[model samples]
Target: MLGFIDSADSHLMSTRSCGACSLHSSHRHALEEIRKVPISKRQILCLIALAYGNFCVAACVSLQAPFFPAECDNKGVSSQVYGLIFGIYELVILTASPIFGKMFAYVSPNFFLESGLFLAGITTVLFGILDRIADSLQFTVLAFSLRIFEGAGAAAFLTSCYTIMPLEFPDHISFLFALLETFFGLGLIVGPTVGGALFEVGGYITPFAVLGTCMILGSLVSIILLPKSGGVTQSKSPSVFAFLCDIGTLLDVLTIAGCLNLIGFNAATLEHHLRQFNLSPTKIGSIFIITGSVYALTNPLWGKLGEYKFDARWMSILGTAINIVGLLFMGPADFLPIEPQLWLVIVSLIIVGIGMAAKQVSAYIACLNDTINRRGYPNETSTYALVSATNFSSCSAGAFLGPSVGGYLLGTIGYRASTQVILGFEILTLILLVLYKLCGS
Candidate 1:
């Protein structure tokens, strides 16, 4: 069992990206708590459960572009009504994450995770049914109600993944997050491909139903694997920051958090731009394929790089730059003569793909190490949760803004102008980094 506990500590759900910085006193206390508990199968179950739930979330997300409009039209809804729907969903996630984070320290993570998966599947199933009912433009009420449950379930599953992975394997925390993040990326890539195929064969109903089924299966796997996680210590909130004894951990985590948000902004805007180009479902799917291939192929390399050789900050920065360039190219891809612009867009996406892979892995690795060094969290699991959620909070926020602005820019000036806006955000992010360094030093 300990051998399943990889010489690498992090699991399919962890995300630390650093090493050997020194554990904080609080981390020492957490590790001590873990040592006192004997390992059991329950801990593994917890991890499997969360991973399955996250996979479900990704499945639904991957199919959105294909299904959402059709689902809405099945009810006589107009295209004019789409923006608020997406916005409301984003709003729910953005508002719900921190609350869920705070809740993780108090509630049973397993219970929270299970309840979330249960609701996510249930509400999604309902979303399918609701689409069939389509009466009037109570769109806000109809759309947001489902989004509330989706957001709640999503936040819960995410928080639990981080919380459980570390406790499941305490000493080898870094590699643990590496595996977790890698699988997470892999799932995100595949979910869409599957969803796209379902869209062609079965339309909107298929993705929703398949997603629900996936959640159900995930629920069962979780029940079996979670018992292995019985070794977990109760979630604790230590005062490493209040005492300021964990600067490296804190800074590294925050820096990565910012970069993660930027990735979301870039990706979200890029997607909307792709749509503006009137790309076919097959073409869009192909782009996802390209992005996923790049991500999946490179993830192992990034992990290997981080093991002993990679400079995480450099990785994060370079990732951000590549994403910016990709986004900028997308603008021209939209309008320019169609031949070179298309190739340019594809190539630019490749760059974005590489950056996203490198950025997330390195940042996560760095965060894991900081948590371990500063707090001595044998798993650095909880800190990973907080940091990841913080990053995603930025992610959800940027995604929300990205679409609205991207849409407006596309409508008013076009994809080229919108791409410029995305570039501006990247520059601003770089400026933010400089400011952070000045303050930190």
Candidate 2:
């Protein structure tokens, strides 16, 4: 499912051992790393600053849902038309990812960031204006045009952040990634909660205006705080296909990396599907926050786990298996004749949340190990963009397909049967893990 890691090369870590490898490896690694590499407090702040900026933009993405309803209603717009506009926004980005990813090697990232923000602001203001008018195909088209600009803008910003972190902070890499994800968790927690409040307090335009100002502000912050990235100045590289066709030591790195990405996305799909059960958005958000917060809290442990001899694949399988079992229990606890106890649902969510945390940490650490073993330093730029793109695309496909799949399973077979689908997928993942071991042997 993940395109960057060449699947064929992931087969080499055959003689694995030490599931009990020390858990303090990340802490130890960081301290020893300090002896070799030193940096000021200001540098660390800059990295956090980049992470903070990225999450602010991402949080605003979901804010549109709450904002759109009021804006559309004020203009006498039907919900269906607004829904269409929102759905089409994904399509625009879907088309743009490959085009941007391919040409990414040649483009100047800073220029890309500036251009994206400029278009985003212009288009977003137009969106607010469109909200004040009656429905017209003309307005619909204009709205979509703006969303495309925003997508391009957001994508560039995200990828650039990935590129920048490796350059700015090289020593404390594991902790750095963990902190990045922690901020991502915070954004998920804060976005809807804050967005919901913004919509309630000030009309629809208030949130958009707020988001526009933040995006502009983030751009300014990025310009001042992030030094020019320390990676290759620019690659006059050949097209992406040629790069893909040529491979050497990096192949194994790519292989495990792809596996890591595939599992991550598949897990995200499960999360989205779990929330689709007629739950209130607040409840859904609550569940995510619980999962995200706890996951962020305990997840740094895997940095130590990654340094061990055990292949990260098994950790993924184990975590996925736990996740599936939790879903199995959670689904039936919701729909089966057994009296619905809220505790069961809560417990189930906690279980799945921990499972997701382990899965993400293991997969990424394995990818990091591979990256470090090869590059002498992590290729944070390439790894971040490739993994994010791969995992997100996979999860997007699954999430888009999940409703219909689950609906059919739930509607025709029943809720119990629908939940069993996760059961089957988890089993498949385990089998794949075994297959990976055998192939490596």
Candidate 3:
């Protein structure tokens, strides 16, 4: 009787194994068929909605940077308080993404996308008119409140889009994702200039009002156009914790965090550092433009490389090396005899931007693929959501840390020394990538 039971259990286990293998094979064949076909009109519409959503959310996030600080000063808010106001948005995003990601088993991605857009749009418009509040305390409270809500909305919208893209464009995941990221970068590039101009014309309220209204309109359109998909099999789906358990996936997440940390570090400190040049605000904005433009333009190239089956780990290492060179020249390092020159700064910013695009895009693809291929997660929407949530959470954490740490280091240790700390981070990332490669091989 015991021998008969063992034989039955063995047969059951083999049957399950065969079923899993067949499912994976079917998924692979479906993807190959998708690759062979032309993109449908529905796919085009979905892409448009996703792209515009990315642009709107990014623009709204950045547009306030140009004028908000001065407004806070005028309202008697201290630099520390106002800076937290900026950092708090990312904090909220970091907190909210995982919840939405976990909800993927129950909620549709389209619902999150549309609702997030609506919520974000409304909060943005409400933020515009905070100038009417007379008391400093009241203004500050409302400012923080509005930003918190805005952050939540943006997190939802971004997480859903990341989830949706892999499902909608499985064949062109890397390239299409890169293209969407390019739009995001463009929005970042355009936001400050547009905000500055609009502020000049109509003060604090105008930029937010206009951008927010447009975003709301965009959200409404997405409701009609975005593709609809059902949730995944909850029984088979792994938790976000499960996904992160894979060492390679965890390192990829860290790589993403490190990349964004450099970006946020620059955003907080670079303008202040450029003050030494006695350049006007307009000129400073132009210098800032250099990095965004380069990053945006070069992303698709990296994405193409990803589609070509480039080894993401090696790409990350190469990109990190380039970023180190950029940072070395960015401060003209203390060891170097040369003074920091504008021309050299320009060149360094460009190099940093290119490296950033490479590192960021490759890390994203690596995380997604590693989760599916090596980690044995299903190639389904739930896995996508979990990966997207993890990546976005890392991004928010990095963004939040970057400015806070950058500002503290800039104040305490001064600019060049602060950059050395950041350089150390990149070097550490490089070392890890090389080790990951060596170990995997």
Report, for every candidate in turn, its global Cα lDDT versus the true structure: 0.56, 0.50, 0.73
The TM-score, computed over Cα atoms with residue i paired to residue i, of candidate 2 is 0.64
- Tens-digit lDDT string for candidate 1 (1-441): 001011123322323333333321232233444465544555545555655666576666544554465455556654435544544555676777557666665566766666767777777766655555556566547776886777677666666666666656665354445455555655566665776677677756676787776776776666556643332344665444442355544444444443334333333344455665677655665666566567667756765666657666556666667777776675564445544356777887688668767766666555555555545565544554554444455456554565445445545665566566666766665555445545742
- Among all windows of ten consecutive residues in candidate 3, which has the lowest summed lDDT? 1-10
> Which parts of model 3 are misplaced by more than 4 Å?
1-47, 70-80, 102-111, 130-139, 162-179, 223-235, 276-283, 303-311, 331-340, 365-387, 435-441
Per-residue lDDT over 228-305 for candidate 3, one digit per residue giving the tens place of the 0 to 100 score? 798733444466666677778878878878776776676666765776788644456567667667876776577567
* Best-matching candidate per TM-score: 3
The segments of candidate 2 whose C-alpha lies over 4 angstroms from its true place after superposition are 1-27, 31-49, 64-107, 117-147, 170-175, 203-205, 228-284, 302-311, 333-335, 338-345, 365-424, 435-441
State in Å the error of residue 405, model 2: 7.2
Clashes of 1: 47
Better of 1 and 2 by lDDT: 1
Better of 2 and 3 by lDDT: 3
TM-score ranking from best candidate downward: 3, 1, 2
Q: TM-score per candidate, in order?
A: 0.72, 0.64, 0.77
Query: lDDT tens digits, residues 1-441, model 2?
Result: 111111111211111111223322444444555567787876866775667565665565545543453455456544445544554444444555555554546665555554555455555545656655565666667776777676666656655555556556666554565456555556656655565566566755666677667667766776676555422354233233432342221232233333323232222223334434555444444554555455555554543454455467666666677776676676553445764344665677677666765665555444444433533432334443443444444333433234334433443555555556656665666666557656752
Clashes of each: 47, 1, 0
Window of ten residues with lowest summed lDDT in model 1: 1-10
Error of 3 at 5 (Å): 50
